[model samples]
Target chain A: MRKLKRYGPPILLISPSLFLIGLFVYVLIFSSAQTSMTDIYTNPQFAGTRPHTFVWFTNFIDLLKDGDFQHSLKNLLLYTLVFITGAMFFGFLWAWLLDKRARFEGVFRSVFLFPMAVSSVAAGVVWRWLLNSNVGDRATGLNRLFQMVGLDFLENKWTNNISFGIVAVAIPAIWQMSGYIMALFLAGFRGIPTELREAARVDGANEFKLYRYVIFPQLSPVALSALIILGHMSLKVFDLIMAITGAKFYPTKVPAVDMYNLMTEGNFANAAAVGIILLLVVLVLIVPYLIHTARGDKR
Target chain B: MAVDTSITQRSGDTGRIVGKRFDWGRPVRFIILLFFLIVVLIPVYVLLVTSFKGIGDAQAVRAWDLPQVWTLENWKSAWQGTPGLPAVAPALARTALMVVPAAIISSFLGSMNGFVLARWRFPYSNIVFTLLLFGMFIPYQAVMVPLYRLVLSMQTTLHLGVGIPSLIVLHVIYGIPITTLIFRNYYESVPQELIEASRVDGAGMLRTYAWVVLPISIPSFVVVLIWQFTSAWNDYLFAVYFGGNAASQAPVTVTLNTIAQGSMLANYGAAMAGALLASLPTLIVYIFLGKYFVGGLMSGSVKG
Candidate 1:
């Protein structure tokens, strides 16, 4: 009774959250793993007639050999590369500029940050209109703007070029998220003490050298944090690409979109396999970062 | 060159030396900032401009032009919807119904869990906390299949409808890791001596938390509330799968997608209006409570 009383309240307080998370997150993941190994058909023709059987790794093997899956993986690789680099570059640029305390700082900051509030679906809808692929006399969106400004060479088929169309899709992703990365980088810039910069200046380190040698090194952790966050988000990107190119559009299709297509088509085993692959890729990017942050908290 | 560098360095130090020196770099910086500002506003300009345009003027070629004829017809049609597509007004209402309860319940549950984990120590609590935090980072796709089946089963066996109520429960569950992380970090900063003093006053853990910790939780509540509100409001993945495509069941995001891609595809004005309408709620929250939103975002990303 004494022991129960001593530990009871805290356990009771945390149990509801623990129970829900366990049921929804852990239990469901295990269930998904199980489903990935078995075949289930939701089609009316197969309903009640087909017996669900464990197919072992057949689904995974099939996905590995599938042309569509290969294309999606390739698209994912290209999208992740472009999205991370573009977001980071623009994020760092805006943060560095704002760090100088320019005029109308509040207005500029709000302008950059406002995109973070809009849903990717909403942004994608607007971008789809803005990236209209029609050219020449029917030029539209950025293309029309380019034509007006005599920068016609800048206009091309955005999200329509088969080989590198995912690059154009990454542009909207960058626009939506670079502001968030800016906020992260801005916080990091502020966290460094003023005394350090003054000390570097006192030692005759020029402005450029001071930043290159002292300031940039201090921001490595922030850069790492932003990279991991952006990396995982790009891996799981769905709605943005979905709204822009639709799920069936092969040029911009990533694994998440492919999984949605498969799931909708009643290919449950294959969908689960794709989902597990996504989860594994995300874990590869996120697990070490989580462990690092957790250890930092102890210090 | 040396004089110019000195002025720049001094401005960096004082941060208020404007107009004291005619620095050449200042104009260049302003030009760069202005260029990016335009880049950021271009799509928004397109959205607003096209939203107000007549159907004839809202074509792809005329995307950058001012509305040749301004009209409220598109807004009306979007709100009231066409024959094939359903109105977004009801979906907006459904989203509100779903987002509010999800935000409130998750925040309160997060507070309690945070209090226990931050202050009340036990064996392997760190491990438990680490395990809970991992759930926040996993792609929902991994669990989407099982979760969908589970909800379906609940609808049949438990008579729990798979509409806003199911969405509320799902959001609250997925929201746990983020909310708990925010609150745990918040409560960690609460001085332990205060808790000890309350304990010396003969109050038990529950009483101490209720009287002591709960009162100081308003700031964290604001942050978590705004974060949860926006995330739940902006969600499309869950809204699509769990909410389904039924006109009565879908949320604003799903409805907006349907409107944008359906017969309204040719009607750019209606599509833009629908997009703006769907984003309005979260945008309003962000405009009004942006500081707390940023605070919540940074807190989630960076440890206190």
Candidate 2:
């Protein structure tokens, strides 16, 4: 009883949080994996309150053959590639420019960083308006600008084009996140001491060579961190796509939206499959990185 | 690469003199950044201009043009909501009710958890921290079906209605990992001597938390509050799946999305207005406490 009292308050204080996380996060993850193996959707009566039939890896096999699933996977890949690259490119560019100690740096920084504050839903809506594809007088935003500048050939259905649909979806994501990536790269740049720069200059290295050999290499971790963050986000993208393109837009569908649709439509097993696939992808990106960071933290 | 040739030739100079290699790149950098600045502003400009325009003006006015006749009609319609659209005011209130309590409770719990994790040493504590951090990255999709069933079952079992309180519990539950992560990292920066001194003075864990740690936690509280509030307020997946079945329970983001997308005839004006309204809370938080927000992001990235 005395020993119990000594440890009881700490246990009480920590248990609620730990218990909640264990139930909602860890256990639920296992349950979701279990759910993906069952044939819950084949017969609703058998499903009742819980999925009973364990179909094993059949759902994964089905997902491989499912065209929509394959398309969502492909779309996710395209979106992740373009989104990460674009954000990093422009982010690094902006950070490098600002690292030069430009005038009104604070104002520029705020403007660049402001988009991080905007919700993805709002970003979707705003970009949807800005990229409206209507021609002539009804044409607005980017399309109108193209026409005015005698670049009518440059105008196209932004998010509506099937070939580039995911790219269009990626635009708002890139916008909302580029500033954040810039902040990361900016911090990375600032952390690179002036001594490093002066030493590189003393070696008669010009700007390009200096950055190529010195600054860029040092920023690999920041880039990798950005990649991990952006990669996970793209894999689980739902709201921005749904908010921008609506839930039923097949062309722009990704796994997160597909899973939502599946679950809402009573395809419990399939939704669980999609969910597991997303988790696998996140694990692929994050697990190794987590181990690496954990090791770093220990050192 | 073209600009690189022109600029890299005389780049060895580091002085501020005009016509130097460094100085020449400055204007070019400014111009390039200025171009991107325009790109950045395009959507925000459209959102602001289109939200105030009357429906006809929204359609007829060139997107880049200033509204010929700025009207309050869109804001009015968005505020009160049309027949199909839910009002923004009530939804915002609902969001605040859930978000405020959840954010506060989670931050407090997170602080205590962080205190124990950082200051108090125990076996497998690092492993425990790792397990908790994994919670942060489990894409909500992975747990959606079970989570939904869990929430629904809890509602029935606890005799609680499908409303904001249930939503609060959901946010608080899922919010634990990130909040804990932020607080743990933040508290790690707090000197260990303070806690040792408090303990030497005969304060127990809970008492030390209340008297010593609580007072010093305000800045971290702000960081966690803004992070959780923005995430909770902006959350659509949870809102749509759980609270979205009813008007009184739906968050502003869900209502705004429904209004924007659910209608047969799209009202760009009102939709833009609703979007702005939904964005205001986070935007205000960002503008006011942007330092903390940036600080949170940096620390979050570095630690994670």
Candidate 3:
């Protein structure tokens, strides 16, 4: 009786969350894995039913050979590379500038961070206009602004360029997210002991040298965490690109968007395959970081 | 450039300058910051300016120009909707109904889980915590198929059309990891002596939590509430899938998307106004409660 009483409350408290996560996250992931191995497609005869046979890696093989999938993977690679680097660079720069005790710090911080609150879909709508590629006398958005300032050379087709148009899509994402990275980097900067800075300075380290050697080294962990967070988010990006380029646009089509398109078309098995592949890629980026943080907590 | 270098050298020498020193870095930094400030606000400028313009004036070719005729017609059309599209006002109400309950329930459940994990340690709790944390990183696409099927089955079996209720449950479930992480980290800082002192008075675990830990959790609660509220309100993927196709059932995000991309596309002013209306709720929350929002974000991302 005492043992039951001792354990019951804590067990009861945690069971609902554990049960829900287990069912929704783990079991559903396993179900998706099962579905990925099947051959389910739309047939008018089986409109409401999901009838299938075990295809055993055929879906994965077909996806590997598919042209659209290949293009999507390429687009994802470029988008992820540009998004991570751009957000990190601007984030760190803004944090560094604000760290110098500038006037109107509160106002500047609010202006930078407010984007984090807006929905990506809303932000994407406005950005689509801003990145308009129309030129000559018909220019608009940044193109028009550039032409007005006599920097006509700076304007080009933003999300219309087939090869690198996805990079333009990353701009709105970076704008919405860089402020978050700034907050993270600022917290990291503040966490460093002041005595460490004073010690580096007393040893004759200048501002540039101090950041290059002492301060930058301490922020590596923050950078790593930021990279992992940004990397996984970039992998699952859907709404922003969807809102900007719509689903039919090929240049910005990513795996997540592809999965949605496939699902809507009743290509359930292929959608499952795409989803499982996305999950695997996210796990590859996230598992080591999770283990690292867990072990750190224990220590 | 020469003056900038001299000021840097002067500041670098002592690391503590006098009040009268003319620092060139100040203007340089201000210019750099102001430049980025303009870059960030350009889209916002376009959003506000276009929302107030007539349809012809809101075209992409003339997006930078001030409206030849500023009017409230777009806001009216967006609010009341057009011939084929539905109004946004009902969707906004549906979103409120969905977000408020989802945020409150998830936060309270997270507090319970956090209290147990943080103070009432059982075996393998760390493993449980790690497993829970992994859920936060997985793409929702991975589970989207099965989740849809599950909800479908429940609707058929229970004879209940799972609409907004399904979305609320999904948000609360997916919200667990982050909310738990935030609350656990918050509660860990609640000195152990408080729990011990309450325990010495013969209170059980639940009583101690109800009386002692619950009172001090207001700050974390605020943080989690604002975070969950914003995320749930901003969600589009799940809202599109689980939220029914009827205009009355969908959230503002989905409705706004349909309005912008539907036949209303010809009316750029209405599309822009719809976008602003969709963004207004969370923007207001952010403008008011930004500090707690940032705190929640940092605690979730930057492990203790």
Candidate 4:
């Protein structure tokens, strides 16, 4: 009652976030949980769990038989490995290079980060064309160039092979995401004071020894953060996979595509099961981090 | 700390010269930047070149090479299409319809959230904030099937004079976690003295946030707006799931994507143009606002 007026605008302003979260995410989560058990059709008779039934593990069981699902799972796992590794390595290398006060830093930074700004679908589609088997009479793109140079082993349909198609998609994801990793690496790099490097030099430390000893430890926090973020990103990846390979073409399926198919095919419970599986994967990574952060907060 | 002692000593000047301090002529640094430039520029150059080539020419040669003839015909066809753009207009309109409102609303909401959290210790605030973060990590695919069912359950009543508030609601849900993180970390840096002073002067929470918290948050606001704006514009799954049959209300991202993937002869060139156009606005905004984009993200990372 003393000065009660302080809460009004904040309350009004904050209402949207809370309200929206309640309506969309949380409510959807609840609905998702409900849908997994219930008959969720628009029809009244299908309102309860009877139509879909509380088919506990049947959905999970059926998924094993889905060629597309298994294919997508393997593809997603492979794509993630390639993307996480590629982005981290190249991103760190570039961050190291650029941290050196290059004259064209701005231009280079923009070029690298440009893909990050681009919608994934747009970038993916273009890459698909460039990698197209028919790009300028078969194998004319990089393939023809490589063939002319006698590196003909690289000429096959890179995007069509089941195993390598994942890598093809991974390239664009790496291209787009490496910059983000670079930024993280830069932040971590800068956080290490110049004095620390000077100290390393003073100890007669070589660059390799210096980084292997001094710089690497300090970079752990940022590296951890980057890896975790990228891990989740690899898990949640949709637009790139969706866009690059047309979702269904040439063994290009990923879990996201699987989820979409499961739902569209009137397999809601299985889709929900898939959704829950994905949620579990993400939660496994995030929940630990959340607990860490929450503990930090409590401290 | 161990390296610090070695590197700063007088005899260590040699070591410093080798690794610590950078001293280089402009040309050398510029030469090094070329590799970085090439790596990043290659695909974009390919995209731009292919976007301008005729369909046959595009498919005829190395898609990465310079075009023999630079024609706007691809752009024209991409825009107009062979059968024409009768299908595009609604999708484009729908995209604009969804993204613009969402951009303004989510950014504004995110800002307000940051302000409120920064200024008050509202009951259950922390718990509520944590709940919102749940959305970000929940794979959309996982929640989506149910979400689709949820939406499908009410697909019709949404437009029966109810308006599409629900769509905005959906975007805001996703936008909150990141936005909240951005603004909250940003406001932590603000001198709390002003907020305290306002409170002492009998200013309420709303007044304090409005007069003190909000104006100072413009940079963070812009950061989240630009980020959320782009993300909302490109949202596909929700739009398709919720508004599939409602083609006239489809966002450009969905429409263009569907068209590009459609069996209509796979006009890769035209579809690529649409993809490029769809991505252009986000790219433009990011380039201009890039400093804040990086700044906001880096700062948020450190704090989060």
**Per-residue accuracy of model 3 over B197-223 as CA lDDT, tens digit each:** 998999999999999999999999999
TM-score of each: 0.96, 0.93, 0.96, 0.88
Candidate 4 CA-lDDT value: 0.70
Give per-residue lDDT, candidate 1, residue B285: 91
Report the error of model 2 at residue B32, Å: 2.1
In terms of docking quality, model 2 is: medium
Candidate 4, residue A154: Cα displacement in angstroms equals: 1.7
lDDT by residue for model 2 over B207-226, one digit each (tens)?
98899988999999999998
lDDT of each: 0.86, 0.82, 0.85, 0.70
lDDT-sorted candidate list, best first: 1, 3, 2, 4
Candidate 4 wrongly placed segments (more than 4 Å) = A1-16, A37-52, A65-67, A134-137, A148-150, B1-32, B55-59, B84-90, B153-155, B158-166, B243-247, B263-266, B299-303
lDDT of 1 by residue, B1-304 (tens): 3233443465376454556666766667778989999999988998898889986784556668898988998898889988987788888999999999999999999898888889876667788788788889999999988887888888888887677888888899999999999999999999999989998999999999899999999999999999999999999899888886647887788888888777435677787888899899998998889999999889888753
- Could you tell me which residue pairs clash in candidate 3? none
Show model 1 residue runs off by greater than 4 Å: A43-49, B1-20, B58-61
lDDT of 1: 0.86
Worst 10 residues of 3 chain B by lDDT: B1-10
**Rank order by TM-score, top first?**
1, 3, 2, 4
